[model samples]
Target chain A: MDIIEILFTASFWAAAIRIATPLILATMGELICERAGVLNLGIEGIMVVGAFAGWMAVYSGTGLWAGVAVAFIVGMAFGLLHSTLTVPFGLSQHVVGLGVTLLATSATYYAYRLALPEVTSPPKIAAFQPYEIPILSDIPFIGEALFSQTPFTYFAFLLVLAVAVVLYRTPLGLAVRAVGENPSAVAAQGLSVTAIRMGAVIVGSGFMAMGGAFLTMSAFDSFFFEMVNGRGWICIALVVFGSWRPGKALLGAILFAAFDALQIRVQQTEIGAEIPYQIFLMMPYILSILALVVMSRRAEVPAALMVPFNKGER
Target chain B: MNLRKNKRVTMRLEPIENPTMLRRLGLPAAVLAATFLVASLLAMIAGANPFSVFGLIIKGAFGSKFAVLETLNRATPLIFTGLAVAVAFRAKFWNIGAEAQLYAGALVTVVLGTGLLPWPAFAILPALFVCAILAGAIVLLVPALLKTRFGVDEVVTTLLFNFIFLLFISMLLEGPLKDPMGMGWPKSARLIPEARLPRIVDGLRLHWGFALALISAGLVWIIQTRSTLGYEMRAVGLNKEAAAFAGIPVNRVLVKTALLSGGLAALAGFSEVAGLKGSLTLDLSPGFGYTGIIVAMLALLNPLGVVVAALFVAGIFVGADSMSRAADVPTYLADIMLASALLMMVLAIMLTRFRVVRG
Candidate 1:
């Protein structure tokens, strides 16, 4: 195949879409949690936990959807754990979050080892099947490649829209946002501030878990130790870059994902050889830093973020 | 009859809710302790004695003269990274880029080690040290710029840089710095003999780097306790607005401390390459930056306490490796131990800072 031909292959874009899936969903998950005033630093660890939980359920014959379900359950459990420490325990928010990340990293990595100590080959499940959009698949140079993506990719797109709605149009969404901005005011208005934040983390983390589950069953088809990597942290930056809006965060994810997709595409073209692969790998990180620094002056973070609310003082 | 009796159940209640600090940690501490107990129990289930397994890890880390020295050797970088974290944490700055800064420092040392610049023995050593410090400072600039200029959260910026530096180092090793001696191994050329850190023992790998680590700790302590910059940084950490109103040059102080923190961390990275490996490799940090976070907390952000915390944590990590090899145990046991210790430290440290009320 010529360079163009090879670049246009269905599998290549599938891989690109695959790479974008976890980041897109996880970032959206963070977008919700942060907008509600809880910086769940455990997103990486939570993603890993979801990966392992999803894998375990599927590996035991529950099928792929069950794997995704378990991931959500796992996410909710962690959300509860983190909320208890920061919200009620009134511990240092950042430290607690960082601690959660470390704990999650070691727990999941070690657990995977013990559960599969004797297996030489990594466990696998039937990977997600690609579903091509009927008419869109016919577009030249883009359709078959972009439209024929795994079902999870499409789900990620829809969830972005869903989150945008829940965050703006609904009463529960307004309350969540209110709690993040000023919990004292929310509490005074007869809302359970902790409950709103907790609910957001629990629900948001469920999406993040699906991001992890998608990795095992849809994206890559197996669990690796620390599978989520640092995409969770990247999402934190994206939420800021997007100004804490769901629709905006998705755009940021795609933009970064586009940079990621472009890097992989350009690498295959021998033209990218002049610049080392490290530069390409570092592109996402570099972009994140640049985007945050360049556009952050007017950035709006949740006013009550990282602050503990005292029920009595309010 | 049974329903009627259940409706009259006794309502006895205990007056004390959380009798001890440990009780408050009942959930996590229990989860953590039970997890280890079960992990150790798994060792027993794996046909190894749990007690012996634990004993072997302790022995492997400190049983022999070489083992103890090696543990100290491994921990040298952690002291600096831990301080890097502590300084930032104290100043309320989240500089997770210590890992990247570590690589930046190592990269500079590699350039110097491979004769990228020419100077006398006396001049080359000092110049390389300064270069390593500067390399670290440059990498930290991204986060500082984002935080100060754009109001971007430094946590994410610094974190993203960690991966960037790692990838940058990988590219260098695979391209400009590839070893040409034998095979396709990805490491830079070995350092010149003169530039190598002097070893302390005849047979052991322990070197003057350990002393350098001690001196670094002392310098950090003096600055934090004695100097005005340290006072300003600490003040900013407590409350940025208040410090700024008091006429503390907040931005300048933050930038300077960030550079110092990065530079210090870079020294640790440089030492590891120069003193231990004599070259650069991809596995430069096995999460020293992450571990430094735990060290900072364990030390309560006290610079002097950082040394003790570093050694203790290093002992656990190395001990785990040793225990794993000798007892046929998984090295992950050590991670479990460290996690438990961190949880313990968090609970203990928080007690001194704030009071947990029943209301």
Candidate 2:
């Protein structure tokens, strides 16, 4: 195996990065909400909402970028709905998440058709066009693979720093973390736990919406039934694997992308021809569980990840 | 929503409000009334008479001998998946991987149906069923292991496997397992006759798998009620710390439930291969596993209730399809109907669980 040959292929890393972005966005979204003490198991449905909303926007003459904004709105709406069910209604997070998934599924399959009967075709607009950096193009393989990408590519990286600042430096961030750790203690100070969490959820879902927007307006630019697939759930797993850190989550996404890329490569070549294809395809999941087992000891899991805060409880 | 400190501490130790039978009956009636009214409105929109269309949907779904058979064929897989979900729900576990488990079961069915087993037909059917069950169980082992050992959330993990498992199946069918008999399509060889689940009431699609599913539901009911293990399991579900104090292995109970859930979902796959398709198709379950969650919840996780609830769901589902072909209404509407019903059911459940009174 010539390392040079593997490194030089544009198609290889492009597809890999494309495959990983949705997971990255979804997990990043999960990270923010998780840090705020609300472990949103609803990211899956949130992404689905984005996928449908994005596609519907495009199918009705709005461009792909318009779809991106629409998806953001849709994602926020899901966050709002989840907030009402969990925060106000006192529903179980797991049950609410499950219900949201079913709702999203129904919405994706039916709501779009109900809303847009005129669009005969499943929306297939222009995806986000890729661009190569001019100065960075001088350096060969690494620069091309790393820098030459879409606007969301840069946003995803920038979001890590932004979220890190908000999580650590800001007063709101401190309040949010304090709430997660001990809501009663925070409530004693008169800061609103409900408001901060609702804000976090909306912002978190915006990140997830970008992920879904990428799937529709960037990844393949067409909406299929169950198109978001299970990347949202995978993102939830990444939140755990990434140890609730945005930087570590980017690495996990890239690592997953690498595995997915390798699967495609194997499918195209004779090297892994002897291996049963099903076994090879499941490599990413197998590796994820294995990585989890090895990393769980070192991971700084949130002390109050999914423990629903009941302020009045003893 | 009502967070009262006085009620939180020791008030729960004493019984408060018990829901009356009229209120309990009212919830289901509301759902039925809403569904019929909504369906009738949709029928009018489609330019068909509401009453006549409603009749047709039911008649096409269950009116004639053949239509009734079709409903049974559709309902068989739902029974298995519905029961699988009911087990998890009773234990307060959310198992969303039934779709993936069903696929895993289907993958196993293909392996046994086509791969060299060196066995007779009668032996092959039993072997295929066992293999399918094993496949489904294996996928669930990860989530169970994660939950018990690492305290990772199983809901996300099991749900993610649904996507991963389906992709693996797609890769297999397209590459290594591509049918030798077909010209380029991603399918496998038809099952050997011995491996096929026998048909019941010939000339219709009803199969022996229906009998197996109903019997399995009975078995689940027995295990959940009559057995000592059931008592311990319910005790763990009711209060994990209390169960642990009483020396029940809480983790072991969860693991067992997870495995049983996976196995039952896989059995749904077994029926699909053995009775419906006669071979593994990519669309094995038609979201039966996902729909099973709604069914199990509607049934309140009672195993016996799952059968009746599953049949009702299956009826609506098949009826939706028939209505689509006959009345030009989209089948996707059924999904919307079910989701709305479940959303309403949750509120109804919460209301039924407790009563609020002004102090």
Candidate 3:
């Protein structure tokens, strides 16, 4: 088949949206956290922890929703740890973030090995099956692409709207944006800056964990060491590419996912098979950098981002 | 007015003018002990006795001459990378791309060393060092240039570059550099005998690379403490605006520090290739670049302290590997221990910087 014929298909579009779901979910969480003036470098580790915890829950015969709940809890715990260190203790954000990642990633590996020692192949569990919306499924190309996804994908899109509303409409959301722009101003207004930041991080991390849980429970049946495969980092980049907005971040995620879907499909085709596949894999990362360079020119980042706020000190 | 000003001067946490020797040493020691205690809990969770696990680690890392040699061998690359990170961090350049720089260096070394040129034996080592360092520096040039010209966040750019270089390596390995006789496994051709570094000990994998690592650390220390470049870099790190106002070329110093960081990390790749693992494989560095960040942090960004810190981390990893083989303890426990230790140390640093006072 011609490359154009292969690219123009409902299945390809469906795959693109499905692939973008996790990025969309994770980027929203990161956007909220960054909006609160803290960068959670621990997202990568938190995702891994969530993926493992959720996988274990499902493996132990718990329902998929239960697995997702477990992931949310684990993600919150790690986020709490990150906030306690970076926000209250006034430690270097980058250092603590890296430490958390190393610790969480390694701890997950150790625990996985301990749980399933000497297994020849990875243990498996039944994954979340796709459920189609009744009337929406009957529509043309857009129907299959948008409506026939796992429940998690549906929740991810809904979350984009929910986050946008929460960030723009509510008193708590105003406090979060104010804290990111000027924490001292928020503090002067009698709101506890630390509390608001901690809340944003915890809530954001829950979404991140949901993304991880979705990966283990929806994308695949079993957990592997490489399952996350830098999606967390990609989410970080997408946040910047999206200019810290929910709708833009969702669009950016979908774009990158389209590229991802395209690459995988091209790799399997005769015309593209002669070229090494690594070139295709490199495209998304390179494009992220270029996009950042362009988008960053007009990007309005939080003023206090990455700076530790000590209430008593200047 | 004077009475009101005096009343406003309430007791609070204040920065120490000069910390006592006991306070300086006691804090890190206490943090270390606490980290180990937490790590023991992890061991217990894994169904292993913590004490025996610690004993096994110590025995495996430092019990005999062979173990000690192995520890030093493991530490050799860490020291180079640690110093590389320390130098850049000292200059406030967040060069998270050392991992990529190391790969670039190793790839360049393999490309130049594998019968590419017929240089004299005495000239090959020096040629390799210069070429590798230059290649590593070149790898970081784009990021440095972008940061200097456009104020790009080096952390994101450097990190993205790492993935690019990794894919580049995979492409090279699977295609042009694929070994003909390896039965389909992707790797570069083995280095010539002259390209291989000589052993430093009687019967150990330890090589002259260890000496090179120590020497590099010492030179970095001197450069950071006793040289004009070091002074400029530190000035830039401390306050770029003030440094620029003082006629110090801020961008120049930052770019130079970045190149230096890349060069030093590339030398780490050279050490690995010349000392152990004579051929270039994708696995030549098992996240040594990332570990170097931990090492540099644990050392408080002191150039000379990186040598000691790198050796200590090397011992932990080497010990953990052997412990896993000798006992039922999983090797990942080492990662947990290292991470906790680093976090604890950061906390201690904060504590040492400020003291709580009664009102």
Chain B TM-score of every predicted model: 0.87, 0.91, 0.94
Query: TM-score of each candidate?
Result: 0.90, 0.87, 0.96
Instruction: Report the lDDT tens digits of candidate 2 across residue range B1-359.
Output: 22223343211111226778977888777877786776676556656687777776788789888788888888889889999998877776678889999988888887878746898666888888888888888888878888899876677667767767887887778777778886777787787777788877666567899998999999999999998768876887788899999999889988888888899999999898888897766777678888888888778788898888888888888788887777756667677677666666775666566543332
The candidate, 1 or 3, that scores higher on TM-score is 3
Every prediction: chain A TM-score: 0.91, 0.90, 0.97
List where candidate 1 sits over 4 angstroms from the true fold.
A1-17, A133-147, A312-314, B1-50
Pairs that collide, model 1: none
Q: What global local distance difference test value does model 3 have?
A: 0.86
TM-score of chain B as predicted in candidate 1: 0.87
Note the DockQ of each predicted structure.
Answer: 0.40, 0.31, 0.43
Q: Is model 1 an incorrect, acceptable, medium or high docking prediction? A: acceptable
* Docking outcome class, model 3: acceptable
Instruction: Give the residue spans of candidate 3 off by over 4 A.
Output: B1-13, B356-359
